[model samples]
Target: MKKRKILIIGLMVVGALALLTGCIPGDGSHTVAKPAGFFSGIWHGWIAPISLVGGLFNKHLRVYEVNNTGWFYDLGFYAAVISGFGGISLFRNKKSKND
Candidate 1:
């Protein structure tokens, strides 16, 4: 059970990384949030891998929704947070065992 939890935590961290890294290029300093295909800039795709893959399979890709922003940093931040929590838990467990 503990291993499974760790695995799940690790996956969550990885998933967060994936989401953060999947961001599109942001606009230049002079440009507004709008860009090519600007109307469909929502970032729904950054939610999960299965959703992205499923959309690709169906040939009805519904990529991101919000423009002028990348998902990478956001996801990366979340991944770090979760991974840090897991690490803290593991470290505490080890310390407890030693004590």
Candidate 2:
């Protein structure tokens, strides 16, 4: 019973993620300009995983913008992705030997 409950919760979480990630619009017509700027890069990076999944089935999907502000946009995107994935544990409290 415990396993069943866990499985259900996991499935729900996965479904929710899919829904959230799948909402980003793709570029099929190639007319829509790529979003630029720092925040936009962060947003794009935050949703990159979802975009990757979307790209798997859709040729028009893109994980990153091609017309961004060069290095700044890339930096923001990478930073957002790293933070989002917990790559750099920012909230963990350090424990000293005294404690």
Model 1, 1-99: lDDT tens digits are 999999999999988766654443221221345432321232332333444554565553323333333455345534544554455676563446557
lDDT of 1 at 32: 45
RMSD (CA, angstroms), candidate 2: 4.4
Tens-digit lDDT track of model 2 for 1-99: 999999999999999886666435355322236447687678778898888988899887888877667788789889889888886577878799998
Which candidate leads the pack in TM-score?
2
| Model 2 lDDT-worst window of ten | 23-32
Worst 10 residues of 1 by lDDT: 36-45
Clashes of each: 10, 0
RMSD of 1: 12.0
